[model samples]
Target: MNLPGHFHQAQYPKRARWFMAIVWALITVKCGVVWWAMPHWNMPTHPIWVVGPTLIFATLVTILWLAHREE
Candidate 1:
């Protein structure tokens, strides 16, 4: 039997989705590490130290997400 129309459309390719999922997992882990280390790293004196990595990762995640979005 034929599938429903909505099921016919493709989503992100399997490889792309897996790659993004891996990246997302890594990002989350990195963020957790940063959160855990911020106190001992002497980064509290400069806010940029905290924000910089976060902004960089956020931008990367955004780019990856947009790249895989359906057009």
Candidate 2:
């Protein structure tokens, strides 16, 4: 028996995966550096400063992953 219709899945290239990996790595490193610098620079330690970007980044990555996901 066969299904009623044909379905096409989205394709994600190896290069795209590598690019995203690098992007996430860089973001992680940047966050670490920011945390390391905050105290040394005598900057104000506000929760929003760190958490806001992190949440936004997470949301963006989730959207990107879902958009490129295979059906």
Candidate 3:
């Protein structure tokens, strides 16, 4: 028997988008925390090691989230 049409087309996309949004929000919040916490290391070149990874991670996460958006 054929299932409901909206299940495959509309609701699926909405659910996927919702999950993706939550994951992205979590990642953003984590980045925010790291941005402030990194400096406490008291190292002279802390930015090079800590800030660099934070930026790279945020960029990669943003790209992945944007690329796999639901239609």
lDDT per prediction?
A: 0.63, 0.66, 0.60
Clashes by residue pair, model 1: none
- What is the total number of backbone clashes in candidate 2? 0
Please give, for residues 1-71, the per-residue lDDT of candidate 2 as tens digits.
Answer: 22324333335567866887788787777777777787778887854598578859776874656455333
Q: Encode model 1's per-residue lDDT on 1-71: one tens digit a residue.
A: 22233432255567866886787777777777776777777664554576578869778765655544443
Model 1 weakest 10-residue run by lDDT: 1-10
lDDT of 1: 0.63
Best by TM-score: 2
TM-score, one value per model = 0.53, 0.63, 0.47
Regions of candidate 3 where Cα sits further than 4 Å from its true position = 1-12, 43-71
Instruction: State the displacement of the C-alpha of residue 62, model 1, in Å, after optimal TM-score superposition.
Output: 3.6
Runs in model 2 lying further than 4 Å from the true structure: 1-10, 68-71
